[model samples]
Target: MMISRKLVYVASLSLGLSLLASTAMAKVEMNAMCFMKQSESTAHAFNPTKEEIADSSILKKNPTNVTDADVDAKFRIASLSKVITTDWAIAKLGPEYRFKTKIYVTPGTKAGNCNLHIEGDMDPYMGREMLTRIFTQLKPKLTAQSCKYIETFSYDQYFPVYLDAMKHQTNHDLGWEDPARYFNSTKTKNDLAAFLKVKSGLKGDFSNIGVVTKDRYQEYLKGVPSKVYSVKSRPLFMIAKDMNKYSYNYPPNVLFEKLGGAEAYKKFAADRLKLDGEDVEMYNGSGYPAMIDGKKMYNLVSCSALVHIMQDLDKTLEAYKGTRKFQMADVMAVGGPGESYSTFKGLYAGGTYDNTMVAKTGSADKAITFGGMLSTADGDMYFAVLTSPETYGGADTTKARVIIRELVQTLAERQKLKKFEYKQIGDMNATDDQSTLVEEPKQTPAGSLK
Candidate 1:
């Protein structure tokens, strides 16, 4: 009996030791690094600096251990994909670009009827608020013009669906639908009716919403013997600011699709940054898990690559042709007291990071990533951190964030950190659609000072 008991104790002790060994070996894999602008250069040139606690295996192409990776190692960068998407938008579209929707109206041969043609520019943010404002303006004009009923309403499919979705608060997942076939003509007509009934204050039914293609619309435009009214969306930077502030998945994907989708962005990065294909792979702008060819794809980027991209984006923002100078926070969420609804609200709030960090954060089932600029007295320091745990969930995200907080603390301790000079735009949900009537610019005074 004593010998049997001794054998059982020995087995239990061995099993415990084995478990401990495995637990010790299973560390979180990560790659975190930063780059600071050279102090003396007029052109902001970055000097790469290592400030991470990672495993040595991180340098290898396929990292076995999770702990030690260098800046060059690749990892899934979740919401950080928004940062890259914003970079592409600013480069391709410029800062002042606005999505415009053209409205053409021709008085019908009969009384109290008019044909309305709306050409949508695929403006992603054309939601309920914008439509309401648009209709409010249109209603007064149409009433003054003596048109009671819209005899023939012609428009692209997306505009009506956007109107319906925004009015009903049903556009929760904007990226999942095929834009070309999202809504039928019948549904679009009904949606337009519902919208006009509630918001437009127009009398009589608006029948027949023709879902016309762009080519067909161009032909129609040539036949129209009347003026065109245009409504312009808010500038791209403001739209991007709200997108990153809340880390909404829809806007980035919409803007990305407009810029030519994920593959195009991958090629853009490769061409512009001279990055190796192995270093960066973007499946979507939102960094959401998507299946292509029956395989799940995620955005993967090296810390070094992300930091370099940030440097590029910053330079672009500084040179933006806007009335006010733009900074990283103009398009990226900033950490602070006022940014209560931003992505960094809970994670980076308080004196340590308040108004000092402008970044994008990403979290998935097994990945947690963050990258952005940290304002310091030395100069702006850009960083990217990617983490993959053995098992990750909501709790794991918290743990990863705690680690990130500590890392930021360590970095802050080393530098004379200062607050970034930018103000938050507050909550995204409360924001109104700031679209405006596109009017011809007034001529400047002959002797106006330049």
Candidate 2:
């Protein structure tokens, strides 16, 4: 068939624009091009088509933009990686892998001067209620009464110090120390208790449910753990929800640590997705501390990747029917016209007096960070945005927010489209075999839904 003139014209125009964009972008140190598309899960697995693709590496008019042969440019993903990682975990491990911070008394249970071994399987926002549950459970029974905490404390005891769930720091020597470290309690055990107290607005002389200052003394049990020990932490889905809503860093990192260690997941991602060691760089899991360029820097992803992952998570809505009410997407963070103001983004970002977006975000080494999903006010779409590596330019997260908002705007616009910039977006070679099994609520294919 003879080439159509209309087709030729559009291709030429896009090529010219992409080339121009490349030239302009290269002037900025390093570069990379990656377009994200909404993903649909097929019976066999998942595939993201190109019509869903949106790009930032180049304008739409480059003369020599990459042909289908060049989809391998190292696109930096930043916190956009959170959704990718989280969804992968859910898909692989099943959604039932929700976090549970459990409190246990050391075997042969002892009181004062005796240890209360607590194991928090990585829940960041798991503040006071969970703590109160532990205290309340052990309340009438905890044997420690008027005992003294040893002065020599291991500083590393207090930790929300997770970098990536699936990975760990090569070195465990954290520099500065926290007073909470003295609690060796690091707050999860007691800080959690205090936070619960504040949350319940519990009445008088109930003063010291969970409090630890310079000194932590043991006392007889009086608190109730079960009245407070109620809900399964908002669910991993909700945790991801809140992460995006707040654009908070700590939780995303914690989730990564909780879901799987960073190192292990990287291996999982590589095996599952078949990642080339050089195609992407995996550091500290989140965006900061590293970057990517056109040559192929996968240090992390961007706001674009974040939204695409949300699209995948949205597909699983049929599973959470019994637990959650649908949440609003991160409208502001997603970046369409008044996306934040008119949609769920604001709710999650603390937009309205009520309602909220829930998602995970990450920021490290002064690098700007982003992650979070938005459910619009209309309640149909979910938008998630994540950004990183711009600490090289923009100021704090405010600038990152603008970039994230734009990324969301672009991706959501793609969601509204019918045609493509003209190409397929994923690589068949892109499967993640390194996946570890994740348990869930008996999953069916995405197609099983209406």
Candidate 3:
């Protein structure tokens, strides 16, 4: 009996040390060498496109939850919202709805000496470079039209939504962090001008918003004078292209308005998806400008829903080639013989690099998300991940992104990670078979963001 007990103790101790040593080895390889091994993590996501062949290997575990779809916050996803906005806009307005900065001249307007009431619909065009290009292309037209001189100019964001105080009540408002002013598209009208009055200042429906206050926009625009020069945005598809490629913000905000109706955000996604769910719902279309009461926190869903949305729209998982709106590829940035910032190669900036990736990444407050199709050597696979902290992490962005990157790569080359017995690991999704392996688990955690 004593000898049997001793043998059992020795086996348990050996297994425990082996697990610790494996995790340590994985971490050390990353710092000491150019390679990184899986941390013996057994987490995985169900690849709907592939069959899971039952097999057993040296089952390892990831230090972090890489294959878990834990997104559940309704915070500002920043640029990530741009793609969804773009997707909806293209579907609604078609490719003809060019988001251009139209230089409308009320029959007679000039360059220097005329009533240049600069106008914008709060559209996602009117960028500095776009303005320069438009001017360059229309220079001959302007010259032929006999443009005259003007001493001063006044600009106005025609759409009053640009004047909104962000339903959110964070102090980030006073700063230039508002998506309206932060991105290239959807810049404030008269943004080029150093001095101009904000035409759309007050909300029309200041009181109860359940109806009663119709024609709100016309009421708001009633103050603008008759003579107005306008600029149309680039094609909606073009703007959408930029939004998706670079993850712009204000562009997506404007999109929710264009696709879901002007004031529809008051109803949130219910007005868009028009479907009820087992999870919480949201009122803001872009999910950014949520009210402060935390009422929108329940808005959540599974990766499968997102996949269906894309499929229904025919946003297929195909590579983007040719002269794309944006282009990105990796190049070796040398520090010392291979001591670079992220040797994974290339600037993480968005673009149609080789036209092989169609994805979106999201981050706001304490939440981070990434969803899309990666055209890997093995083939294409759709992945979505969400991380919601109890509170937003103000400064530790690196930690969040690192986690996102780990999740992305883990799903990208799942074969690299060994498999283990499935256990009740999280709060999102679980099934009857506790020992069955899963590729991706849907769970929510109250982890500290910092």
Q: Specify the highest-TM-score model's number.
A: 1
Candidate-wise lDDT, in order? 0.63, 0.35, 0.35
lDDT per residue as tens, model 2, 1-450: 122323422533244344444444322212222333323321111112343233433322211223222233344554545456456655454444455433322221222332333334455544433444434444444333322221111111223322121111111122111112322243443443444345423222233333222122112112211111112343454354434433433455555555565576667556755454444445533333322243323354322333444565555543445433332231113322223221123312322112223334443433333444333333333433223343443233334433433343343343322211111111111112212122223222222101
Q: Runs in model 2 with CA error above 4 Å?
A: 1-70, 92-97, 106-115, 143-232, 290-298, 301-450
> What TM-score would each prediction reach against the true structure?
0.75, 0.47, 0.48
Task: List per-candidate RMSD values in Å.
Answer: 11.0, 15.0, 18.3
Compared to the true structure, candidate 1 yields what TM-score? 0.75
Comparing candidate 1 with candidate 2, which one achieves the higher TM-score?
1
Q: Identify the leading candidate in terms of lDDT.
A: 1
Model 3: weakest 10-residue lDDT segment is 28-37
Residue-level lDDT for 260 in candidate 3: 54
Query: What is the full ranking by lDDT, best candidate first?
Result: 1, 2, 3
The lowest-lDDT stretch of 10 consecutive residues in candidate 2 is 422-431
TM-score head-to-head 1 vs 3, winner: 1
